[model samples]
Target: MIKRITDSSAASPGALCRLLWESMLELLYPSNIYCICCDNLIDDSRPYSLCDDCLTNLHWANERTCRCCGKILKEGYRWDICTDCSSASHSFEKGFACTEYGGAEKNMLLRFKFKEKAYYGEKLAEIMFDRIQPEELDVDLILPVPMHKRKEKRRGYNQAAILAYHLSRYMKIPFRKNILLRSRETMPMKGLGAVERRANIENAFTVSRGWDTIIKNKKILLVDDIYTTGSTADACADVLLAAGALRVYVLVFAAGANRTV
Candidate 1:
């Protein structure tokens, strides 16, 4: 989670450094000057800093999404839930995603996560903010899927927290970064099967000790950059629910295509 700043003039040293870095990024990659997806020039009128071609090509998950996981289902499939959700249970009450994890989304999200393009989070979150409005979700608080301290320090930022921060600002919901934490780092989920992923992520999250009162009986929106097997979200949701959260809903920028079989 990004550190909270009570005041700009008296920011903590870490906050001050992030502020300076953001300022530099603003000058170098100002919004409305370049498209976030295809890098073509775009005007402010284009939403989310996307060019017309990229916007047209972007795979919006506007149809046939799995009811449980919110991943785009295969065309003409006669199922309400995806294959993964049908085969296993998830802790999250529901899930929402803005786009399908297609080629364009994969490229853009890779840049946002691995490249020094933190500003891309703003555009992605703006799109997610739009997605949330239609759902009419009434979450009491927003939190990000946490990263282990060592890994976060190595990466310089947590992509999920960046998305959650922008979402909190757009939705006016209170955002808490330190509540749910990644207690340990596990092997990267890439190339792992669903069972392996779940085992890898199990018991990897824990809630802060003193946040029970605030979490009790409250609805939570769990923010993340992507949703794959739902292992990561399920682990975090299990911890949050154990800490007394009423319901945990997941919101992501992109989701993997639903399995047909």
Candidate 2:
């Protein structure tokens, strides 16, 4: 009898080729060996694959932040909440972020979201995880601000989901992607005023069937790539609260500049 290689026992030609290609790529161009922001060489010990300079230059949101929205407030600004938060009531209980949305942070996040650099999600999530206080981890579950099916399909992946997935791993919280969904397509939020952005995202999200029971009385942690105007986050929080979630707190990678009047 002759022994034959089964599909399970033998490497397929395509798999072998891919393995070789990946091996070659790793040998020639290693991953995480360079800073994600400036492409400077970084060591394994560097947190978030960022160099010392990039890390120092990054706009961390650890300074005075808006009490309601978590965006960094300018110095000498006496308001607890940002101008945007003061003008409108957000559905979320509160929010926190890892960095301010500007300069290097903005450029990096834009590349992460629109340029298909999904690996950035991991480092961003790690930073966001560091932003969460011990008491904030009391949430019962974690969820991403969902993207519409069409948009997600077109974009290849939902950035928020990617961030939330990594964040769940870091925080050891249960993460659900499909429980909260974007049920409607909306226009681009860019260039939209606060009211316009709110209206654009209104009713855009809904809880899936059978999730209401699980959501009921649960303290939820909502994750997103960025928080601007609180429109999308508020919309998602509204639906989650309506589905019986006791509380929805937001964790975003970046918070837009405080629109102080």
Candidate 3:
């Protein structure tokens, strides 16, 4: 009896091509790939890791912004200042935010924080770097605003740390993770007035003992994902300044369009 043999190549060209393509993909990209915005399969050629539709929907802060804080400012507004900054005094010598907290930008931030899409940090950092003026940013260290130990353990990562790591790489600054510690975990600052938020975060942070020597008379760039009332950043800056940091500047990915106090 003669047995019929199947030639794998002759069986199906499409199947063979698919297998080769899949192998190439495995070698080229991450296994669990998905769109950053819509959780759909990402196209191999898209510039962003987001699907086309979601990428189109992304609203960049493509307008003029406050030089001090990166908040979107209307056309004809005075240069270097926004209404909010004009009225308020910020502890951070200066700040930079990439986008306003609305539309796709807001969604991306939410995903980054609560959904573990930590890779977004790189993209956000890129945007931030573009907005920052290199001549104005001479810093000795990149310090991330710390999350409390309990919260850090629960999340398994701090978003600010991720942002700081990327910013450090982009800016060539030393990234220090343990220099600042969140000594307390206060209630969420959302919905609270600016004064309340400041009060809540006051005394919530402390610089680690050895950090005093390292940061003494050194310029620092504090990295955070958001700047709401500036409470968290202020608290961190206060500790760093008190510990002898020469100057403290903040870099955030987003900030409220309208700020009070």
Residue runs of model 1 more than 4 Å from their true location after superposition:
1-19
Candidate 3 clashing pairs, residues 3+ apart or interchain: none
Q: What is the TM-score of each candidate against the true structure?
A: 0.92, 0.88, 0.80
Q: Write the per-residue lDDT of candidate 2 for residues 1-261, one digit (tens) a residue.
A: 111111211122333443455456546666578787878998878888899988998899878999888999989999888998887888999999888887889878887778656567778888888899654558889898887887776665677887788788778888888899889899989899988998999888899999899899999999998888999999999999998999999999888888776
lDDT by residue (tens digit), candidate 3, 1-261? 111111222122333443355446546655335666667886556554667787677645567767666677766665667766776777778877766676777788888778644556666666677656554678899888988878866664677887787777778888888889999999988899878998999899999976689999999999888877677887888889899999899888887775422
* Angstrom error at residue 38, model 3: 2.1
Candidate 1, residues 35-126, lDDT tens digits: the string is 88878998878888899899988899888888998998877888889999998999999999999988999989988878756667777888
What C-alpha lDDT do the candidate models reach, one value each?
0.84, 0.80, 0.72
User: Which residue pairs show backbone clashes in model 2?
Assistant: none
> Compared to the true structure, candidate 1 yields what TM-score?
0.92
| Ordering by TM-score | 1, 2, 3
The model with the greater lDDT, 1 or 3, is 1
Q: What are the RMSD figures for all models against the true structure?
A: 3.6, 7.2, 11.8
Best by lDDT: 1
**Distance from true position, residue 162, model 1, in Å?**
1.0
lDDT computed for candidate 2: 0.80
